[model samples]
Target: MDMHILQALKSETRTGNFVGIATANLSSRSELIAQLCEIAGTGRLQPGLRILTDYVGASHYLLARADLLQEAGLDFVVSSDWPFDLVTNLAEAFVGGFGRATELEKCMQLFQPHFAVLPETADVPDGASRQYCSLMFNIGRSRLALMFLFDDGFILSQERLRDVGLLTAYYTSLLQYSGTTTDRDFELTDRELECLFWIAEGKTSDEIAMILGISRNTINNYITSVMRKTATKTRSEAIAFAVRNNLV
Candidate 1:
């Protein structure tokens, strides 16, 4: 199934108003990695690709395999309690379709990433000056995140980013049909989901209690349950998770 997806991707990555290929020239997944290498002028390819379940801080991923990026401490992202303040507070428009990060200087402030541990093959330039592009696809109740890395020399045009995002969404649906999706969501009760939905809409516990015809204490309890199940540290974090995962 992955091969078939890759084969389809070969023809899907071309970016143009109908003319040229992007800098990545991403004919295949390997080519995508090679493009990163080419952009960095590294002459060697050690790339990382993590297709996440959400564009935000995600605990679970659909697929994770990146030997190249693990050098920079990216491998620890899922287990770490690192805060993604920007992703949690992203505009609704960004999450609804496709979006790219790091191209616009102002938006870089949203995501927090520690420096990459430089690989043994030091072909690329300084890690501090590297360019990272994360492509996100919002599919129904599911979201897909693809993270790309290269040096500052790479010119990431918006058109190329959009093409990558669209092609990635294509593979996301294929993965779904092939049953590559696993550990989708922690089991949240109906009451917990209801509470999360209301909370996302700016409802307080007392308001949710009145709306659900339940006691405020019960409303709080349900929220607590949601927090516990989602492994979120705070109510705000839990709500962010709900919104990112389309649970609300």
Candidate 2:
């Protein structure tokens, strides 16, 4: 939220896509942790997982905690509308294989800065499968993979995928930040969180006020309060902080 960064985002916001990358890069670890806390604090993993789906534009997404996989297989799909049988049949093997294999680990270390495209092959169910998936590896106890399904021929830039990976790390941190935002006692009023959400979407205070049927000053106050609670400085910093932390 430095004044210089705020000015930069303001200037870039006018340019659209470039600004998203800039803004996303400027997000802070603390704010990202705060959002993760909010997600983890939900108690239910599904909602937090859904945030990843939305953030990455995936039709289906899953986060199977490595150690929790049952003797039979992965306990839950984590997040998705992916076919049930598809998940049930292949979930355990993939988790187990991913567990035994060191490739997943080495991939995390070496291939991290690069995005991975997983082929729809034997492991993934044919009926529920797509032509391509972009995976960002996340390690937590066991191997955790963040998979993004895209239509055929969809291409993502390396730098953009790196951004996705960084954001995914924050997404994983929500589970890691279990004590804070995840605490049942840790709460930000609905209105306050809502304001933060929209601001992250790049809405102006006036736009948010109009959307919420509140005055501009009230809208600004809500944002200011969010910054105070989240310990962020400027609005750009606040939003960047939110993005990095997966707050929105």
Residue-level lDDT tens digits of model 2 in 5-96: 11112111111121122222222335434555676656555666555444433345655433233445343234555556656655655555
Q: Which candidate ranks first by TM-score, i.e. highest?
A: 2
Candidate 1, residue 18: Cα displacement in angstroms equals 31
Model 2, TM vs. native: 0.42
The residue-by-residue lDDT of candidate 1 on 19-138, one tens digit each, is: 222333334444544544443332111112222211121221222111111122222121211124322322122232222333343234222221222223333223222223444444
Rate residue 106 of model 1 by lDDT. 21
Q: List ranges where model 1 is wrong by over 4 Å.
A: 1-137, 141-149, 157-159, 170-187, 198-203, 206-215, 227-233, 236-248
Locate the minimum summed-lDDT window of 10 residues in model 2.
1-10
Q: How many clashes show up per model?
A: 3, 7
**Residue 103, candidate 2: how far off, in angstroms?**
6.7
